[model samples]
Target chain A: LAKTTQPISMDSYEGQEVNITCSHNNIATNDYITWYQQFPSQGPRFIIQGYKTKVTNEVASLFIPADRKSSTLSLPRVSLSDTAVYYCLVAVNAGGTSYGKLTFGQGTILTVHP
Target chain B: DVKVTQSSRYLVKRTGEKVFLECVQDMDHENMFWYRQDPGLGLRLIYFSYDVKMKEKGDIPEGYSVSREKKERFSLILESASTNQTSMYLCASSSSGTSVRNEQFFGPGTRLTVL
Candidate 1:
């Protein structure tokens, strides 16, 4: 299991691009970087994921360096609704037969102000 | 989209009582998980099941147990409810294939209060 470290909290204004970075020095070779957004009183929702380099989707973009020791989640055009706790996870599965037990750290709370 | 449903949105239980929390997924996923979320602790895994009649303890499994009698249903049980056991219980399911990206789909969550 890899341990991810991220900022405790961050604040951004509307229409701004927010980038949250996570450090996982001990990430395993089979680990994949994943990000999740959790609003108040709700379960965490998958935002984006990446194995290496960069992966972008309609929701957000994931940037993983060649070393794979760190990753960043970029949100384009933030809004008040984007205010939530963002979690960075290094997912490692033993095999297809088992559940990929995700170890979640204290996530970064993003507050988007208008 | 995968849908994971929990039995209750909110629940209240007394100390020394036996409590059961149920979870069901419509996606016929092979893996089901039980997690408890706290303020600073984030989400801690309580138990998980890979297949029917199979279970495994998670990071914080001291006072919690789980059951998976059927493929789509997984249950978490608290033998003796305590105040510390009161928290947000979440159920998640994920397919066995990496084709779905191996991401866990979580339920809305159950807020349990022990008196």
Candidate 2:
């Protein structure tokens, strides 16, 4: 498994875009970058995922550079409710030898204010 | 929606007591996992079962044992609860296949406190 490093905390305000970046220096070719969001007292929810380039969904966008060493999760028009802890993980998908174990680090805490 | 449900939202037990945390997934997923979350350590995998009657130990599985009797259920057993075992327990399930992204769906979590 590729170790992931991200900011310990970030601050944002309403209507602003929040971008969290994760660096995985030893990322493997088959590893994919995935982001998850967790509110207090709740399990983490899947936000978005990408292998390379850019992938956007109804909630967020993931931009992975050509190098694949790092990836960024972009949240558009953030609100106070968007405040939560965001986890970035690099894991091998279904085909690889991994058996669906996710290693979560102390994720970045996004605090959104009014 | 994929639903994963834990037996309890909060539980309190005494030291040396037996503890069992149950999880059930309605999506018929092939993989079920147990994890514990602490203040700063994030989530650490305790155990996971890829199929019924099969199990695998995760990063922190010393004090825990797991059972997968049926396809939809996985159980985490703590033979003797300790204060250090108190934390939020999370259960997740994901389908098995060759898809590129196998996102795990999580339950609400159970907060266990050992006295």
Candidate 3:
């Protein structure tokens, strides 16, 4: 399993673009970067996932460099409701199974100010 | 929409008492997982089942056991609950296949307090 490092906390204002970066220096070949957002008193929700290059969803965009050593989650227009803890995980399955038994680190907490 | 549901939203148990946490998924997913989340420890996998009656230990399987009698249901049992076992327990389910992405659907979670 690859260990990931992210900022402990980040702050942004309304309508600002917030970019959270995660560093995984020892990523494996089959590893895929996935991001999850967790609000207070709720389970983490899948935000976006990408292998390389860029992947965009309605809510956010994922940018992965060629080395795959790191990735960035970009929120186009932040809001008060966007305040949550964001997690970056490198999915690595055990014995070719679909379940990665994902390692969730102490994620980056994004605080959106009004 | 796919849904993963737990048996309880909140529970209170006494020390030395046996505790059971139930999780059910409606998506017919082949993989079901049990995880406990703490303030600084994030989410740690307790156990997971790939198929019916099949189980595997995860990162933090100590003091916790799981049963998967059916495909859609997985249960986590703590033989003797202790105050340290008190935390938010979350359940998740995902399909089984090498080609499928590891997008798990999570339940709302069960907040258990052991006194």
Candidate 4:
């Protein structure tokens, strides 16, 4: 498991793009970077995942550089409803290993203001 | 859609009483996990089961135990509840295969209050 470090909190307004970066200096080659979003009182949901380069989904995009030391999660045209705690996790998701055991670090809380 | 359901949304228990938090996943994922979340501290894994009757201790397994009697069900047990043991418990599941890209589906969470 690769330990992750991210901001404690961030503030953004409606329609503004929010980019949360997570650094895992000790990330292993087999480790994959994943981002999850958690609303109040609800469990976290997977946002986006990427090993390198860029990957986009309906909700967000993930950009990983060649070094793989850090990755960024980009949210486009943010709304107030997007305010939530964002968790950046790095795990070795190889099957039969520890796929379900995700070590979640203190996530970055994004507070979107109107 | 993968649906992970916890047995309760809220639970209250007395000190020293036994508590059980149940989780069931509909996707028949091969791996199931138990995690507790706190205010400042992030989610901490207590236990995980990859197969039937197979379990592994996670980072914070001191005051918790788990059971996987069947493929879709995983249970977290607190033999003696304490005040400090009160927190939000979450369950998650994922499929099997070769890939570090598999994502986990999480339940709504069970908030246990020990008084």
Candidate 5:
């Protein structure tokens, strides 16, 4: 499993765009980058996922450089409701030796202030 | 919308008691998983079932067991509840497909406190 490192917490104002970067220097060739957003007392929700380059969706965008060593999650027009803990994960399969284990880190806590 | 529902939002139990956490998904996904989340530690998988009557132990599965009698439901069982088992339990479901594109849908969660 690839260990990911990200900021413990961040602060952003409403209407601003927030980008949270995750470093996974040991990312494998088959590993896919995924981002999940978790609100207080609620389960985490899938935001976006990408293998390489940039993938944009209605909710957020995922940017993965060529090296695949790092990736960024971009949230547009943040609001107070967007304040949550964002988790960056390297998705792996449950088959084979690794199985389907999603190892989560402390995650980046984004505080959106109005 | 994919919806996963847990039987309880909060539960209180005593030590040395048996406990059961139920999870149901409307999507009829083939795979179901149980995980526990704690502050700073993040989410840890306890058990996962790929099909009915088939299960695999995840990273942390010592004190937990699971059951998958039907395709839409998965249950997590604690043989003897302990205070250390207190945490937010999460149930997730996903369909087996291409590894790169599959995403797991999570339930609201069940906060369990063993006193």
Candidate 6:
């Protein structure tokens, strides 16, 4: 499993775009970058995922450079409801001894201010 | 839509008592997992089941045991509940595929407090 590092917290205003970057220096070639949003007292929800380049969805966009050492999650037109903890995970295929486990780090808390 | 329902949203149990936490998924996913989240520890996997009657221990499985009698249901058992076990328990399920992009769907979690 590749360990990930992200900002502890970030503050953004409503109507502004927010980007949270996660660094996985030892990311494997087969690993994929995934982002999840978690609200207080609730479970984490899937946001977006990407392998390389840029993948855009209705909710967010993921940018992965050629190095694959890091990835960024971009949320367009943020609102107060978007204030939540965002987790960046490096997904890997399970093998004989390793089961598919989504290891969550100390996620970045994004506070959207109105 | 995929739904993962937990038996309880909040549970209060006494020390030395046996407790059960039930999780059921409607998606019929082959993999089900139980994780406990704390303040600084993030989410720690307790146990995971790949198929019916097959289970494996995760990072923290000392005080927790899991049972998977059917494909849709997975239960976590606490033999003797302790105060240190008070935390938010989360259940998640995902499909078994060859891709590296298996996204897990999580339940609303159960907050357990052992006194």
Instruction: State each model's CA lDDT, in order.
Output: 0.85, 0.86, 0.86, 0.86, 0.86, 0.86
User: Any idea how many clashes model 2 has?
Assistant: 0
Candidate 2 deviant stretches above 4 angstroms: A92-101, B97-100
List pairs with backbone clashes in candidate 1. none
Candidate 1 lDDT, A15-111, residue by residue in tens: 9999999887766566577888998877888889888999999999999999888899999999999999998877444455343436666689999
Fraction of native contacts, model 6: 0.54
Tens-digit per-residue lDDT, B4-86, candidate 6: 99999999999999999999999989999999988756677899899999998887999999999999999999999999999
Residue B98 error, candidate 3, Å = 6.2
Residue-wise lDDT of candidate 2 within A1-114, one digit each (tens)? 456678889999999999999887666566577888999988998889898999999999999999988889999999999999998766533345643335565688999999
Candidate 6 B-chain TM-score: 0.96
**Candidate 3 lDDT by residue in tens digits, A89-113:** 7754456554443666568889999
Give the local distance difference test score of model 2.
Answer: 0.86
Docking class of 5: medium
lDDT of 4 by residue, B1-115 (tens): 6799999999999999999999999997998889889876788889988899998888889988998989999999999999999999999998863234678889999999999
DockQ of each candidate relative to the true complex: 0.46, 0.52, 0.49, 0.53, 0.54, 0.53
Q: Per-residue lDDT for A59 in model 3?
A: 98
Q: For candidate 1, lDDT tens digit of each residue in B45-108?
A: 8997889998888889987888888999999999999999989999988887433257888999
Misplaced by over 4 Å in model 4 are: A92-101, B97-100
- Which 10-residue window in model 3 chain B sums to the lowest lDDT? B96-105
List candidate 3 stretches off by more than 4 Å: A92-101, B98-100
TM-score of chain B of 2: 0.96
Q: Whole-model lDDT, candidate 5?
A: 0.86
iRMSD (1 decimal) for each model: 3.4, 2.9, 3.0, 2.8, 2.6, 2.8
